[model samples]
Target chain A: MAEREINIEDITKIEGHANLLIKIENDELKEVRLGVHEGKRFFEKFMVGRSYKKIPEMAGRICGICTVAHEIAAARAVENALSVKVPECVEMARNMMLISSHIQSHLLHLCFLALPDYVGKDNSLEMDVETLKKIYKVKEAANRMTEIIGGRAVHPCDVVVGGFSREIGREDAERYGKLIKEAMPILEEIASVFLTLDYPDIRRQNNFASLYGDEFSLYRGMIKTSKYVFEEGEYEKYIEERSIDYSNANRVFVRGEDFMVGALARLNFNEIDGRAKEMMNEHGIKFPSNNSCHMNIAQALEMVYFAEKAMEIADEFNGCSERGEVKNENGEGVAIIEAPRGLLLHHYVIEKGKVRYANIITPTAMNLESMERDLRWHVEKILNRDDEEIKKEAEKLIRAYDPCISCSVHVARVV
Target chain B: MKIGVFSLTCCEGCSVQFLNIESDILKLVEKFDIKNFRLIKERNEMPVDIAFVEGFPSNDEEVEKLSYIRENSKILVSMGACASNAGIPGMVNYAGKKAKGIKEYVDVDYFLYGCPFSIDELMELISCIFHGKEFRNKNQNVCSECYLRGVDCLLDKHILCMGGVARAGCNAVCPYNGHECSACRGGYEGIDIKSHARLLLSKGFSEEEIIDAYEMYMHEYVEELKKWLKER
Candidate 1:
C-alpha cells in the first residue's frame, strides 16, 4: 500500500489562515486535522480597566464585517448595566440599523461569497458575465441599504454608546424605504437564481440553533432550537463553549452535541413557522435538512426573507411619530442580535456608570463545532480521492458555514 | 516564488482588502506559490521566498509564529497597522494608570503602516520582491504625505486628526475623504508629541478633550505625550 502526506499550509480567499493536513494511505484518508494557525486576541484582557462608556467603541473595532452588531450589543449591555431605558424611537432606529446589517451581510454572503462555490467559480468575478452582473446588482442594493442605515457597509460609525449619534430624518427614512422597496424585486430574483444552482448534496441531522421571534428579527430574541426556545439570558445554559486544544475559537455544543446555526439553522426554524416555506419549496429546500452542505441554499432563501423583513420594518417606522429612549443610573444589560452570520450575544457588567466586564459571543464561535463535524464527515467520504480533490472539498465544506473568523478581532482570511 | 501571509492581532480588514482586489487576486494565485497562507485553504509546507505578515504579535504564541515565519522566509514584510505600531490592540497598553505600553507588552518585527493594509501598496511590495528590488522601510509620518498633497490639517479646523503622529503610506485616506483621522494607522517615528499637543491646545481645544480624543483609540501614545508635556 502507498502512503502520502497531503498538507495545505495556507488556504486563501476565506478570512483567516487554516492548515489542512490529511494522511492518505493507499489513497484513503487515515487522519485529517484542520488547524487554525492564528492566535486569539485577548479581548477579555483588553476589556479590563477600560471605562464602560468606551466598551461599544472599543468592541466595535473587533470585526469590520459585524461592527454594528458589536456596537449595538455593547451599548445595550452598558445600558442594562446602568439600568437606563432607551426611547421607543431609539429602539426602533437601533432595530433598523441592525436589520439593515443583516440584509446587507446576508446578501453579500449568499450572492458574492457562497454562490460562487456552487457555481464552480473561484470568486464572484469568475462567474458568467451575465451572472456577475446580477451579483453586482445585489451587491449594489446591499451597499445602498448599508449606507442609508449603518452609514457604511463595512464598519458603521453611526452607532454610539447610548444610542445612535445621529438619527435618520423622515426624508432619509423615506429614501431608505424606497431603496429597500426597489431592491425587493431584485432580491427575489437573486433568490431565484440561487434556486437554480446545483448545491452539494450533503445534510446533517444535528440540532439547529438560532434566535427566533416575530417577523424577520435580528434583535431581541430567545435561543430557539429544534427541541426548545428560551430567552436570551438562557443561551448560557443551552449553548456551551469549550476551549479546544487546537483552535482559539471555542468549540460549541448544544445539549452535549455539536449543533449548527446561521442560515441553515434560521431557515430550518423559519420553516416550522411557515416563513419562506413557499420560497423554500420553490427552491427545493426542504425543512429539517440533514446536510450542512445545503447551507448555501438556506443562505439564498434567507436573503429574500431578510429583504422583505427590512421593507416591513422600514414601513412601520415610516409613519411613526416618536422614537424610544431608555434611562437608568446603573445596572447590568444583555443584548442578543442575529448578525448576518448568526446569533451575537453581548453581556455587560456595569458599576458606577461604567462597564465592569463584557462577554461577547459571536456566530462563528458558535458554529465552530458544526464546521469540525462537517469536516469529519467530508473527510470520511472523500478519503480515497486525490489530494487536490480532497483539499477542494474541504474548503467548500468550511465556506458553507460562511465563518466570519475576524469577528473576534484577531484573525484574517485563510490562505 | 513561494510566499507566506500571516496575521497576528488585527481587524483582518487588510486581508479582506486583498481579497477585495477581486480579479487581481486570481492573477496573484497564478503568479506566486503560497506556502503558508491561513486565510485561504490549507496547503503542505514548502520553501518560502517572501512572507507577508499582518496584525501585531499579541501573545507568546504569536511571538513563536512570527519568529518561525521570519526564520523560514527569505524576506519578511509586516503588513498592517497592528504589525506596524501595534495598531488598536496596542491601545490596550494604556489600561493601567502608570506608564506601560504594548511594545513592552508584546514582541513584533519590522513594520507596514495602514489601518487596514492597502492592496495597491502590497501589490507594489510584492512586485518589487519579484524583481529582486529591496522594499524600503517607511520611517516617515503620515503627515508628510498629507502635507505633500496639500491636504487640509484637521487640527486647523478643530477636528481630531492623528496624521501628525501616525505612520504614513496610506496617502491620508481619512483626512482626504473629509473624515477625521481615527488613527487606524499606527504612530510615526520621531513624533514630536509636545508640539503636536501644543498645536491642538493653541487651536482652542481643551487639554482634557485632546487627551481624551488621543486616548480614546491609541492610549499607548497618551503616556508618551504626557511625558513629553512634563519635560516641556
Candidate 2:
C-alpha cells in the first residue's frame, strides 16, 4: 500500500490558468480536483443595464480563442429576445465567420498548444523549422479568413446584434473564397498529421451533449443530449448548473450527470460532410467516439468540414445582403452554437433597450465535471507511475477537451 | 536576452494575437530567446531581460505574480488595455472591486497599449529593448490615425465613436470597418474631453450613449465625462 499526493500548480500550454490536485491513499485514488482558478470577469452581471446592441462586443471579451463563438451566440441571443429574424444571407455571413473561427481555433489548439505533447516535444517551437512553417502557413491563412470576415481575429466588431455592420462586398467574397481554396490542401495535410498520431487508448461510454442538427451548421441548432433532446428555449429546464465553493465556474450537469461536449459531442450528433466520413475511415477512426483523446482527431476532421462549408458560402456569395434591425422589444432569448470546442450557450434578457439579465455557459465549464471524472479514471490505470508521469497523463486528458478556462470563468448566473 | 510573456486574468487576446503575427512570429522565434511564453512553450526560465505582461491584477494570486514578474525582469512592459487601464476585465471595477493597472502596483518602464494591443508595437518594443534604444508609447488618438488612413468619420454619421479620444495603435481598424471605437486602448494625451462631449451632445447623441460608447470602462476619459456633466 502506498500514498500519493499530486499537485500541478499551473498547467502549461493551454489557454488560461488552471491547476490539478489529487490525493491517493493506499494506492487508491481518493480525491481529485480540476481547479479552474481564472478570476471571474463577471460579464453576465456587468452586462446588466448595458444596451442590447453592444452585448456581443462585451461578450467578445469572454475568450480570445473563441471570440467569434461568443459574438455569434450573443448576437443570436439578442436577436431572439427582440424576435428579429435575420435574412438568409446574414446567416450565411455569420456561418462563414464561425467556420473560419473553427479553422483557426482548431489549428491553434492542435498545432501550437496540443501537438507538441503528441510529437514528443516540449512545445511546437521546439519542433523542426519546416513543420513550424507548414503549421504557420495554414494557421495564417485561417486567421486571415477570420480577420476578413469578422473584422479582427480576437474581438470582432463587424458582428453586431442584428447582423454585420459592414456588408460583404464582391471583392472581399472572392478573396475569402480564394483563401479557403488555396489553404485546403495544407490544412488537410496538417489534419492528417494529428489524425494519424499515437494517442492513449482509453475508451469509456459517457453522455455527450452538443447542438442537435443534421446539417453542418453552428449558428442555429437544438440542444441534443444522450438521454434527452430539447430546443434552445428549454435549455435551463434541461441543463442544471450550480456553482461550487472551490471553482469560479459552475458545474454543469445534464440529467444530474457529468457529460462531455465540444468537438466529439457535435460529431456524435450531427451529420458532417460526406468526405469527412471517408476521412475517419481513411485515418482508421470512427464517429461516436468514446475516448477523450479522440477529441483531437474530431477537431482535425472538423477543420476539413468547416473549410468546405466556408467554400460553399464563398461560392454562393453574390452581393451585400440586408442585416436584421433590432426592434428594442422586451423578452428573453437563448442561443446555442457549436463552438470549436463544443456547445456554447449565451442567454440574455432584454428590457427596454438594455440587457436586464444574462446567463452564459461555455464549453469548458460544461466539460469540467467530465474532466475530473476522467482524471480519476486516468490516474487509476497509472497509479504505480511516479508523480511526473501521472501529472502529464492527467494534463493530456484535460488538454484533449481544449478547455478554455477564461470562457468558463467569464460569466456566472448572478442576480 | 531572455524574454517572458505572462498573462494574469484577461481574454489573453494579446498573447493569442502575438501568434497571429503569422509568418513574422517564426522569424521572431529565431531572433529572440522567448523562454517563458506559456502559450507556446512549457519549459520556462525566469529572471528574464524583457517581460511583457497582459491582464491586470484582479486577485491576490495575480497581484503576487505581477510583483514576481517585476522583481525578476529588467524591463517590465505592461501590454494591452487590461494591463494599462483594465480593458474589458475592468468591468468589475464598476462593481466596487477595482482591477488596477500594472503601473498602479509595479514600476513599469514601457507600456504597449491596445485592446489586443498592437503586435507591431510589441515587436518594435522588443527590438528597441534588445538594441538598447528607447521605446516611446504612441500618444496620438485613433481619430488622427483614422484621418491618416482616410477612414470615414463615424462622428459625421452621428455615431458616438471614442476614436477622438481613444489612443492610437490599432490603426483605427474598427472605425475603418464602419464600427465605432469602443476605446479598448486608454485615452491619448488629452487636453479637452468637455468639448468632445459637447460635440457629441450636439450631434443628437444622448450623453448616456456617448459615455457607454466608451463602455463606462474604468478609465480617465469616462471620469472626465462624468465630472464635466457634474460641472454643467
Candidate 3:
C-alpha cells in the first residue's frame, strides 16, 4: 500500500491564491482541502467604526473585477439599514452597473481565463490576434456602459447610500443604449466561440440556489432552492457559514447541504433574455444544467442577456436627481447581489451613522465547498489516471466556477 | 527583453489595467517577451529584464515572493500605489502588522504610481525602456490637472478635495466629475499634510473625517498627519 499527496501550491489564471490539497492512501481518497492562502485583509473587521457613507468605497476594494457589484451591494445594504427609498432612476442606474459588470466579468472569464483551457491553450495570451481584439472590444463596450452609469469601470464612485452622488442624464442613457446595442453582434460572436469549446462531461446534480424573481434579477429577490424559498434578509436563518482553519475562506451550508451559485444557478431559477435563451436552446442546454461545465455556456449566454438588458434599461431611464435625504439611526442591513462568479452577500450593522459591524460572504466562498465536492467526484472518476492528469482535470473543474479566491476569503466572526 | 508582471496582496487592478489597454496590448506584447504574467499568460518563474510588481507584501509569504522576484529581475518596477506606498492594503494599520511596499524589502528601479496605476504612466515607462528614450516622471498635484482642464474648484462647495496635495496625472477624473478626489494616487512630496488638515478643519470638517480622507490611500503618511492634527 502506498500513500500520496497531490499538492498544487499556486493555481494560476484566477484572481487570487488557492492551493488544492488531496491525500490518497492506497487508491482511496482520504482528505481534500482547497486552502485559500490570500492573506486576510479583515475587510469586515476594519469596516467597523467607519461612517456609513464611506462603507461603499471601502467595500469596493474587495475585488477589482467585481468592485461595482460590491459597491452596489454595500449601497443596497446601507439603504436597507437606513430605510432609504431611492428613486426608480437610481435603481435603473444600479442595474445598468450590475449588467455592465456581468458583461465585463463574464467576458474576461470566458475569453481570458476559462476559454484558454477549452481551446488547448495555456493562457489567453496564446489567443490569436484577431480573436483577442474582438474580445477586448466587447470588454471595452461593457466598461463604457459602466462608465456611463456608474462613473468609471473600476470601483464606481457615484453610488451612495441613499441614491447616487451624481445624476445620470437621459442623453447618457441613450448614448449607452447605442453602445450596448452595437455590442450585440460582438457578444454573439463571443458566445459562439464559447459554444465551440469542449467541456469535460461531468454531472453532479447538487442543490442550486440563486435569486428567484419574475425577471432575471441581480438586485432585490428571494433565495430559491429546489425545495425551499427564503427571503433576502432571512439568509442567515437558512445558510450557515463555518470558519475553517486550513483556509481563509468559510464553508457555507444551506440546511446542512452544499449548494452552488452563479450563472448556472441563476439560469436554473430565472428566465434570461430571449436572445440568450435562443442561443442556449440552440446548443440543447435547457435551464438548470447539472453539469458544472455548462456554467461556462451559461456565462456566455448571460453576456448576450446583459447586452439586451442594458439597452432596455437605458431606454427606460429618464434621468433623475442623485440626491436622496438620509435619516440615519441605529439599523442593520443585508444585501445579496449576483456577482460575476455567483451570489455575494454584504451585511452591515450601523450604529449612530457609523458601521458597528460588517460581514461579507462572497460568491467564491459559497462555491468553495461545492468546488471541493466536484473536485473529489472528478478525481475519483479519474482515480486510475496518472497524477498530472488528475491535477489537470481538477484545475479545469475549479476554473469552471471562475472562483475569485481573494474576494472569497475574508475575516470570519469566531463564535 | 523579457518582462514580468507579478501581484501580491492588493486588488490586481493595475495588472487588469494592462489588459484594459485593449488592442494596444497586442502591440505592446509584440515588443517585449512577457516571460511571466499570471493574469494573462501561464505563470513562469524565469528571470526577466524588467518586472512590474503590484500590491504590498502583507505577510511573510508575500515578502518571500517579492524578494525572489526582485532578485531574479534586472529592473524591478513597483507597479501601483500598493507596491510603492502601501495603498488600500495598508488601510488596516490597526491590524498590528504593517503592509509594506516592495521597496521596503528590496531595491526598486521605478514606481508606477497610482491607486490602480495609470495606464498612460505605465506605457510611458515601457516606451522609455523599449526605445532607450529619456522619460521624465511627473509628480504634480491633482489640482494642477484640474487647473489645466478648467474644472471649478471643489473647495468652493466646501468639499474636502485631496487634489491640492495628492499626486496628479489622473486627469483629476473624480473632481472633473462631481466627486471629490479621495487621493487614490497618494500624495506628492513637499505637500503639507498639516495644512490640508487645517483647511478641512477650517471648512467645518471634524478631525476624524479629515483623518479618514487621508487614511483611504495615504497609509504611509496618515500617522504623521494624525499626529499633526492631534497637536493642533
Model 1 DockQ, alpha carbons vs. true complex: 0.24
Which parts of model 2 are misplaced by more than 4 Å? A413-415, B94-96
What lDDT tens digits, residue by residue, belong to model 3 across residues B81-148?
Answer: 77887776577652476776778899988888876677788888898988888766578899899999
**Model 2 lDDT per residue over A1-415, tens place:** 7778999888898888888899999988899998888887888887998988888888888888899999999999999989997888888778888898888999989998888887778888888889888888888887788888878878877888778878777677778889989988888888888888888766764799988766657888778888998999898788888788878788999879889998888888877765666787887787888898888999999998888888888899775658887666789999999888888888999998888989898998899899888888888888998888888888788788888888888785553
Clashes of each: 68, 2, 0
- Which candidate comes out best when scored by DockQ? 2
Q: After superposition, how far is residue A274 of candidate 1 from its true place, in Å?
A: 11
> Could you give candidate 2's fraction of true interface contacts?
0.75
Docking verdict class for candidate 3: medium
Assess the local accuracy of residue B55 in candidate 3 as a C-alpha lDDT between 0 and 100: 81
Task: Please give the ranking of all candidate structures by DockQ, highest first, separated by commas.
Answer: 2, 3, 1
**DockQ of every candidate structure:** 0.24, 0.78, 0.62
State residue A114's C-alpha deviation in candidate 1, in Å. 3.2
Chain B TM-scores across candidates: 0.81, 0.93, 0.93
Candidate 2 lDDT over residue span B163-209, tens digit each:
77777888899998888888787777754678778878888898788
Ranking 1 against 3 by DockQ, winner: 3
When 1 and 2 are scored with TM-score, the better candidate is: 2
lDDT of 1 at B29: 64
